[model samples]
Structures are given as structure tokens and as C-alpha cells.
Target: MSNADLPSHCDVLVVGAGPAGAACALWLARAGVDVVLVDQHDFPRDKVCGDGLIPDAHHALRRLGVYDEVMAAAEASRHVACIGPRGGRIDVPGTVAVLPRRELDDIVCRAAVRAGAKLRTPWRFEAAVVEGDVVVGARLKQGDVVRETRARWVVLATGAVPQALQAADMCKRRTPSGIALRGYVKNDAMVGRIKALEVVWHKSLTPGYGWIFPAPGGRFNIGVGIAHSHPARDGEPAKMKDVNLRKVFEAFCAHYEPARELMRTGTLEGDLKGAPLRCSLAGARYSRPGLLVTGEAAGSTYSFTGEGIGKAYETGLLAAETLLAAPGGVPAGTADDVRTRYEAALAALQPRFDLYERANRVNAHPWLADLLIWRARKSERLLRRMAGVLEETSNPGNLVSVRGIVRVLFPGA
Candidate 1:
């Protein structure tokens, strides 16, 4: 659509029609709020991600009333197999699903539109329109024309795009926490052989891991992620910026016999893509006057596993709930109330974020991860507990506690 055709005002203007923005709009529109959801790209756009949905993501989809659709379109797996650095393997049974972002995102965004949210595509967010320290709306560029969208509130769900946050003066940190690369490969033989999601912790990829997730139609989503701030083994200065993620991923495939064999007969479906990740543990602010941030823009991605879909959906719901609960429409001074409530809701998730941060530290140590996997392999109780962690049914803190450590060390007890 042309910039001239865009709406001049709305009750809420949501930038980015991804999961977060879509969910927020879905809930708001369902509540009879006038919401405009905008994105640079249209439906069925691919996003660089592992594309695996854990149980938490399933719950989020259910809450959004789209779980049935996602499940019907996704590949369901009840097991997660992990290969530690020392080659020790552990398999935990749980509920997980994988669906390409192209389809998953389209489903959610369509739901938002069906629920009466206005969706504008190819709308590039340029900057926030502020008046006296309050964001009254946003300026957007479409093609050669620039347009302004006035709204009572604005939501920034633009994923990890730093320019938007930086322009709004909301970005708390300049450096990204980590980076990840992903691509799809078609291999019927490999897909048939691997019924469960697989994660490998190679010693070379400290503080990061590799994954193979089953996608629809005999395809696999393969990827690797590493912390940008991870230290070099020899104590030399880390040249993270100089590192080539593609080369690293190639090395990973070459080193792992299974991955190598799988890729040997498989054809690459697309060029490998990479993206930066910001973790919620970084403590980035989620809201400011007349504006709120959700998804990766708010640092909602988990620090340890790089799992953002579930958290993104969650923050979207919370943002919508906060706005819907306000007695009247948001006024200039009332922005603070919205900010306070959103921050408090985010605070409730801090424990999980802290646990994931601690787990990331454990992941850095190859031997520690190997030992834990080794023990879990021999004990059904421990295995079940580990599965619970993946399903998010059990607290991650239990796996790191002294008592929990003792139980794992002596499973017979």
C-alpha cells in the first residue's frame, strides 16, 4: 500500500507483524480496540530461527487460540536428544513441535486480521513521533513517500532491529549478546532417522549449541548459536566480530559425524542466514511513555537456549492485558501507569530468566554438561526431571540447586 493510503490515527499502532505484534493485536482487536499492525514484509516471510516450539510455546499458541492450526501444520516430537561434548547422549521425552517461521508467522498474523486488527504491509518504521517526552505516534516510510501514524499508544515489536530502539532512545545496551545461523535442508532419509529434536554441545562451540529440528515435509532446520561475549580458550582477546558464523557452522557439521552424514545426501534449501540475539537477562526496559516494547526488542529471548517465541508471545499477551485493563483510554500522564504495570509483569518472569543465565554458564563447561547428561541417561527419574525442564513444567532452578545437584549425583537415593 502507498504511504498516502495509510491511516492517520489508531487506538494502538503496532510496528512489526511478527508473533509478538500479532498476538498483541489479536488480543486487543478481540477486545474491540482499534489497532493497526504494520510490518516491513508481508505474510509468509521467512525468519532466521531454529523454529522449534517447546511446550511453553504450545501453551502460548493455545492461549492465542491458534494451537490447533499450528499443530496441524507442524511436526510434533515427543523426545529431545542431546549429545554432550564428550559424546555422551541423553534423550528426554517431552512435547515439542517445529514449524517454519514463514507458516507460523503467517498463521498468527492472519488471526490478528481476522480478529479485526488492521494490518499494513511493506510499511517501514522510520521513527517515533514524540511531543513533550510522550510518543504520540510514529513516522513511517513506504517507498518514496513518508507518512505519519498518530495513535494513543505505540508498540515496538520489531524483533532485534537495533535502529528502531536506538532511535527511540530505549535501547539499554549497544552490543548484542549472541548470534545464530540457520538454514533448511531436505533429506528424507535423515528426517526418517531423526524422529526427535537433537541438540549437540561441541567443545569448540563453548557457551553455545547446535540443533537439528524436524520440519514439515521431510526437511530439517539446522543451526548453531554462540555468545558474542564468550572468552577464547587460550585467554586471548575474543575476536567475535571477526568470526564467521557460516564457517563455524560448516566446521560443526564436519566435526559431527551424524550431521555430516545427514547433510551429505541432503540439498540445501536456502542460503544460511544469521541474526543477533538479545537476552532478557540484559535488563532492557520494556516500556516508556505512550510506547511499549515486546519480543526480541524487549530482550525477551532466553539467555541460555535462545528461545524467544514463547516469551515473545507471552510479552505480547501481557502488553495487551495491561492496555485493556486501563479504566479509560491512555492519556498523556497515564503512560506511566501502563509502563509500571508492564514492568511489573516482566518482573514476574525474572526468576526464569535468571535460571537460564545460570544454565548458560553451565553450558560453557563441556565436562559439566557431559557429566549431567551421562547421569541422566542412566536414571529414569533424572531423565524425567530433565524432560520437565524442557517442557517448562518444572522450575529450572531445581536443576541447579545444591539439593538437586546431590540428587542427580546419586540418583539411586
Candidate 2:
């Protein structure tokens, strides 16, 4: 967590030591690659996230060899208490847990450092070091002291922030696809009352959904996310909806009963904070010349659920896998091959992101949630499939497709 450990050159330069960058550095270091991980902020920093860990998150944690550690520090839940627009509820079973990004990210970053990755904090990526069209490394800054570190390849895991991507000219979209607001609450009275990770869709908060996930120590990570929440018109790119997220959070508290109760009974531990999201594998190119983008930088967040920790972890591993596949795990001159393979690995996950986008229709139409939950109360198969979405074993498209409407209309069908 100090600039003192900064390397002169490395096999890979990983910018932004969040889950994605940390995970990539961990994997590469474990594989004996000289990876240098840098971050703008110091350790144990807070990030705006819902902190809801689903099955995919667990899988990725296991892959990183931190499943037990993360789980041990997390609050385990048996089901997600999904409430509909009309207040109908269904407890969908899944492997769910909650852990704040502050602690979660610290663990990943420490793991990478322990794995032999040189971690340098307060070292912000200023721009990529370009040799003609290839990105050989980056210029990093810590206060007024700037350092130029070269690498065979560069990996950008800068999360949803746009400055680094824009500086590196890796940003395809100037604005974020979605915006979210979140805050923490601590109340012992609600610990047993709010046992599950709760999600609600209300018509008043259109194009967005709210989540209240219970963490350990009588705390709850509460938030709402909206992906525009729009479908682009004509050939224009997506746009962030011009609504005050504070007003949205107020509306979320007004419309939802549990949110109101939690607000009324619980102590707000911190001020409500907002963050932008890059979703659906859009916004930035996966690779360019000797550089690769992973995690939220490459839009690893899902448009539907806003659960990204899992995909973020997976993308970093893929970046490491791609590098490891290269000869000597550092194919310095094979930018074309590296780009093709790394981008292809990202493209393979696109269909799932698309399916999640289909499910985002429920956010725009909360009544659909009422109908689905009502029907799910009767049809066990539909409910099981709903659980599959949380488990990452089934397509979310099945729940919102045209035929899905027919099933919701006719439960037995």
C-alpha cells in the first residue's frame, strides 16, 4: 500500500486495485508473473455497491481462493426476499451473502500483495505509455511525484470512473450507463426481522430497483440502481436519466414499506453516497494494442441486477488467463493475438449480459414484478427458475420474455 514497492518494470501493469485489478494481479502473481498493481486511493476504502453476493460471486471467490475467507467475514443468507410492486413477496432460495466493498476489496488487495504482486497505493494512472499504436505501460502519479512504469502489457481495472479510461482514450461512452445511491444502517431490532437480501420494484421508482441486504454486525447495505433506465432511441447511444438520485432514494423510502421501517427504526451510519456504473460490457474496448481492459472499466456490470462483483472478478481472471496462455506468459509483441483472445473471452459472456438487459424491463414496469411474484407464489417451477437467475444457472430472459408473460398469466402453463 506504499509507492516504495513500485517496480521499475513488470510483466503487466494493473491499474486500479479494486476487485478486478486485485484479482488480476493475484492470479498473475500466483502464476509467477511480475505484476504491479496500482490504485489512486489507499487501502480499506469504501466503494458504492449493493454488497449482495450471489452464486457467481461465490464461484469467483472460490476461484480466487478467498471463498472461505470472504464467507467467514460475510453475513450468510438463505434466500432473497423479493417484493413486488403491489407488496407481494417471494423468498427465492440461493447462495446469497453480503459484505461491504471496503472490507471485501481490502481482502482482495492484500491477497494480491501476498501473492507477490507489487502493490502501490495513492499511485493513480495518468495515461497509457503508447509506442505508436501500442500501449506499452502507463504514467502514474502520486501527488506531485510522477513515475513512468513500463510493462509488456497493461490492464485497466479502474472500475466505473471515466477519467482513467478517457485519459487512455479507452472510453467509448463519455457518460455512465447507470447511476446508484447507497448508504449503511445499523439496527439490532431489524437483524432478525430482515433476514434475507431484499429487493423491491416499485412503479414510482421507474427504471430502477431497490435492495436492502443485511450484513453482519446488525448492519444493512441499502441502495437503488437505475440503468438510464432506458432503451436508446433510434441509433443514439444510451443516456443517463436526468433525475436527482437523492429524490429517487427519498422516493424509494416513501414507496417501500421495509425501507420506510428501516429508515424509521435504524440509525443511518453514514451519508448516502452515489456512484455511476458502466454496464452490459459497453463503454470501453476490451483490448487495444498491448493494453487490456477488464472489470467495470470494460463494462462488466449487469444492466439488470447491478450485481457486478462476480463478473468483475471473472473478467480479471480471464485477463490473467489470456496472458498466461501466451508464451512465457508475456507475449510482448503479439498484441493482435492477445487482443483477439482477451476480447473473445469477454464476448463469450455478452449473451448473459443481454439476457440480464431483457430482465431490466421489470425495472421499467414494476407491475410486471407484481404479476411474476404472484404467479411464482403458485408455480414452483417458475420460482425455481427465478432462483436459477440468482444462481447464474438459468437465463433471466426466461422471466421477462413474451412467452414468460404467458407463463405469468397462466401459472400452470
- The per-prediction CA RMSD against the true structure, in angstroms, equals 2.9, 1.4
Candidate with best TM-score: 2
Clashing pairs in 2: none
lDDT of 2 by residue, 54-170 (tens): 898899899899888898999999999889888999999999999999999999899998999998888989999999998988999888888999999999999998999999998
Q: How badly does each model clash, as a count of residue pairs?
A: 0, 0
- lDDT of candidate model 1 versus the reference: 0.83
lDDT by residue for model 1 (1-413), tens: 21126799999999998888999999999988899999988677899988989888899999999999999999999888888887888878888889999999999999998999888878888999999988999998878878899999999998886888887778876567788999899999886788888888877676678888989999999988886453344855434556678777887797677778778899889798999887854525688789998888888888778888988899888899889877674433278788888889888987888787767755576566677798887877778778878877666666766776777887655
Regions more than 4 Å wrong, model 2: 229-232, 235-239, 331-333, 411-413
